[model samples]
Target: MPKITYIEHNGTEHVVEVPVGLTVMEGARDNNIPGIEADCGGACACSTCHVYIDPAWVEKLPAKEDMEEDMLDFAYQPDPARSRLTCQIKVTEDMEGLVVQMPEKQI
Candidate 1:
């Protein structure tokens, strides 16, 4: 399992271990983390699971696909260089130290 750190907008953090093959949004949802809503159930159809990747981890994640990029247009405040839709990122051992910060609010 890879450990993922989810940070809330208010600066609180939750570090949880997610099994390999699960999506990042699923890790948050399963652990009851407060930030990622996952409204589309990992379908990449909504921006509610939007988050900002920690600067150091930004280049480590897979590039966003067209669908995820389009949906992020509806997120609260997306950063072109850091914003990512959690549902699109599958967990793997290489992401053990991954960190993601929630926006102030989701759309």
Candidate 2:
């Protein structure tokens, strides 16, 4: 399991251990973390699972695919440099210590 940190807009932090092969959204969902809704259930069909990757971890994550980039347009407050759909970020050993911050709201 790899540990991931999810920070709410108000600054609450939840650090969780996620199994490899699951998406970052799944980790948050399973832990009852409130920030990511994952409304499309990891299908890349909605922007509900949006979060801002911490600047330190941005370049470490996989680059966004066209589908993810497109869906992010619908997110509430997207930052081109850090915004990402958690559903598209699969957990891996290399992702340990990954940190993400939730937006003010999901749209």
The numbered model that scores best in lDDT is 2
Q: Write the per-residue lDDT of candidate 2 for residues 29-52, one digit (tens) a residue.
A: 999999799988999999999999
Displacement of the residue 41 alpha carbon in candidate 2, Å = 0.7
lDDT of 1 by residue, 74-107 (tens): 9999999999999999999999999999999998
Provide the RMSD of all predictions against the true structure, rounded to 1 decimal.
Answer: 0.5, 0.5
Clash pairs detected, candidate 2: none
Overall local distance difference test of candidate 1: 0.94
Instruction: Report the number of backbone clashes for model 1.
Output: 0
Once fitted onto the true fold, the runs of candidate 2 whose alpha carbons sit more than 4 angstroms away are: none
Query: What TM-score, over all chains together, does every model reach?
Result: 0.98, 0.98
